[model samples]
Target: MEPRLTNPAGLLPDVGQAVNILYKSAHTAGVPGSVLELVHLRASQINGCGPCVDHGARAMRKAGETDDRLFAVAVWRETPYFTEPERAALALAEYATRLADRPDAVPDAIWDEAAKHFSEKELAAIVLWIATTNFFNRLNVTTRQQAPANY
Candidate 1:
């Protein structure tokens, strides 16, 4: 679908910069770049934001992630490709993204699993990453942002 208009980031430079700053903070929060990409890709897939999914995959690949693991992110539970920590992060991403589907968004069990793997600071970073990706996903989906042809 065609975008409804030019990307809002271009139209509102200040807002775009603010988002960029927030995104940068997440990157420095000590979470691994690879994990963050997985979280971003899973959330984008669930939100059906093609641009994000494309960008996330490319970013993951650039960080040295393999195609098989990236392809199996959607079926993480069925695959033996991920470590326990990765599984926790993916579960957190799914639960957080599907908040409206349940009353207790991000149930304790999921949080507990994640806690077992990530330190408190890393957990906070993961939460922020999930929230940030969701924000971008909603914006892209609403604007009908399409992935570049080369993506």
Candidate 2:
């Protein structure tokens, strides 16, 4: 599909830069980049943001991720490709991205599981990553941004 408009971040470069800064800082808390990638891909998938999902998966693959893991990401719960920490992060991404689907957006059990897998700092970073992904997902979906032809 053609985009409804240029990416808002592109039209407003400062907004893009601000998001880039947030993304960079989100990596400072020691959560593995792999886990962050999973979070991004899962959230984008949930939001039906084809552009973000395409870009995220391409980035992961370019970084040497295996097809097995990438293919199983959408069905991570039934797959053995991800580690426990990765699973926890994916779960958090799902619950957080679907906040409107439930009254208790992020239930304590999910947060506690993520906490058990990640330190406070790591959890902060993970949440930041999730929030950032959601922001981009909304932007892309709202604009009808198209995925790359090759994706």
Best model per lDDT: 2
lDDT tens digits by residue: candidate 2, 13-65? 69978998998889877999999999999999999998888999999999999
TM-score of each: 0.95, 0.96
* Pairs with backbone N, CA or C atoms under 3 Å apart (clashes), candidate 2: none
Q: Which runs of model 1 end up more than 4 angstroms from their true locations?
A: none
Please, what is the whole-model Cα lDDT of each candidate in the order they appear? 0.90, 0.93
How many backbone clashes are present in model 1?
A: 0
Off by over 4 Å in 2: none
Candidate 1 has its poorest 10 consecutive residues by lDDT at 4-13
The numbered model that scores best in TM-score is 2
